[model samples]
Target: MARCVLQRLLLLVITMTLPMMTMAGEVSVAVASNFTAPMKVIAQAFERDTGHKAILSFGATGQFYAQIKNGAPFTVLLAADDETPARLEREGVAVLGTRFTYATGKVVLWSKKADLVDAKGEILKTGKFDKLALANPKLAPYGAAAIQVLEKMNLTKQLGPKLVEASNIGQTFQFVSSGNAALGFVALSQVFENGKLKEGSGWVVPSNLYSPIKQDAVLLTSGKANGAAQALLQYLRSDKAKAIIVSFGYDL
Candidate 1:
């Protein structure tokens, strides 16, 4: 009986230590739709350094708020604006003191073709198209910027009815990329990659058009005890990570 017991104990010890010795379990994240491109850069770098994978769910801040409220299994959140993480902390959904701004987002009016827009920002006067797409302001920060730009130019009265609403920035870009809408408001980073434009042409919306998009991050209380979760938060703020973020049309 003693011999059998000794063998069983050895087997259990190896089973427990084997995973810890060689692998990092993936961390799950709920990232704001607008931050998708930059997050990809951040994730790739993090994985190379730590051997841990980030499983990301991209969507609107409002929808993420709803999911976390209903007990979604997410370890971290990178929001499109500061309000969501602030609210999550207030509601006891995220770890207090773990929330901070990660990036500032920018919005742009983009077209699949250069001729479709004018540098003077007079695409509206061109009159070659009818539909304009933007994220739903209620759900997305960039969407709200699109509305502000229209209001600033006093074109909201004429363009309001022609607006096509996307549930999130990803969908907003998709609408234009697929030609479902002639032009759309999307994150400046969407058409850009590694500090260069990847597809199409765009007019960067003026900063005066809307409030700054202060994106935030937090460690969900559900994953408070996780070493990997904290590691991810730290990784995102590292100098190397910041370089990639800046490349994606965001400011640290």
Candidate 2:
């Protein structure tokens, strides 16, 4: 009789726990390529803390905008520029007033060789390198900032032929990492952490050389019905997430 009672109590506990386990849901997020590393850290923490899962897709903000318009089922957008999220809000694709600036990014002219890039980025004027890599300006905000820096230094015309453009900031970083390009422009976050470069040498471009790269995040219409999506966005603004972002060399 005691054995029968114990078995009945164990079954009751298991049945009660099943409903709570199913409460955890998944959220799909579209993230900017520049934020890949930081987002990976944030996503893991979000899942651990809330028992929810985050499905991340990383690419250029421009490409994400196109995909969202074409009915991609994204629950949230973490864009490389504030403008992209603002536009989505105006177009009724994202929830109004749901947009918020997440981080401000810095651009850098980087090279894998320790001595290839100078502090002032004067190599652009010398035009000695065979190829200079940058993201496609039309598709990446970081690429646009890179162009602005070149134009400010009067090297645009001189370096035009030597330019190698990638589809996004992540690919632009890869070009230099693989040594296919002598040097390239990349997000500071890609090669930096704890206020220092992880590898290679780079010139942190002056703020005066280009416009601010204010990144933003927003909840999308497709995600409005998903509670997990809203929770993820809220978690991104929490102190824990902010610490991770700062650790990755981004400005809040």
Candidate 3:
């Protein structure tokens, strides 16, 4: 009887765990560079709750768009701007009605030095820095926003010569953090955590300076049959993911 009980317990355990093992899957996601930190946290939570894994690739949204157009195998896209996903949807590469704004981003003028950037961003007028880094405006929305900020302040012409362009917001942050550029316009999430700046000094660019950065997420055509991909998209809309996004200083 004890032997039969042991066999029954083993069978019950297998029955309970087999479905989770079979349902667990991996989704490949192309994510914007600015969303990296928060996405990592959310992905972890998603895996824990749903038994699915997220495989993430981070880069400039424009580059990801090009890759998707070329038939990249990405299952989903988390873009820095709403335009790219809408374009994909129009082109029939992404599923219609699957795109939505996940986060609204803010840009900041930041420096590794503790006191280089003033609260009101007077440093842009001061012109004390030799190299000011920003992502390539042609490739990154954050870069375009930075340009708008400079133009609104009427300092673009004066600062143009000192500008150093990076391929993405992540690289832009590296340029400033490495001291190659004294200061740069970067996503606020890069330098903020848990309601405070992680390091250095920064000026939160006023919203009036540029268009809103409405970051969006979408399910790609390649993901339509992917259970993990669908789960991840739904997970992104959950309160858990939104809290993580907010913790990283992004607006919902």
Q: Which candidate is the best by TM-score?
A: 3
Decoy 3 TM-score against native: 0.97
Q: Highest lDDT, which number?
A: 3
lDDT of 2 at 8: 100
All candidates' lDDT scores? 0.87, 0.94, 0.97
The digit string of per-residue lDDT tens for model 1 on 1-252 reads 999999999999999878865767678999998888778878988888987889989999989999999999999999998998999999999999999998998888888876686666788655467789999899887888888888888888788778899999999999999999999889988887766668777788778888899999999999898777888999998999988888889877
- Sorting all predicted structures by lDDT, with the top scorer first, yields 3, 2, 1
lDDT of 3 by residue, 1-252 (tens): 999999999999999999999999999999999999999999999999999999999999999999999999999999999999999999999999999999999999999999999999999999998999999999999999999999999999999999999999999999999999999999999999999999999999989899999999999999999999999999999999999999999999
Tell me the TM-score of each prediction against the true structure: 0.89, 0.93, 0.97
- lDDT string, candidate 2, 210-230, tens digits: 999999999999999898999
Model 2, clash count? 0
Q: Which regions in candidate 1 have their CA more than 4 angstroms from the true location? A: 1-23, 125-127
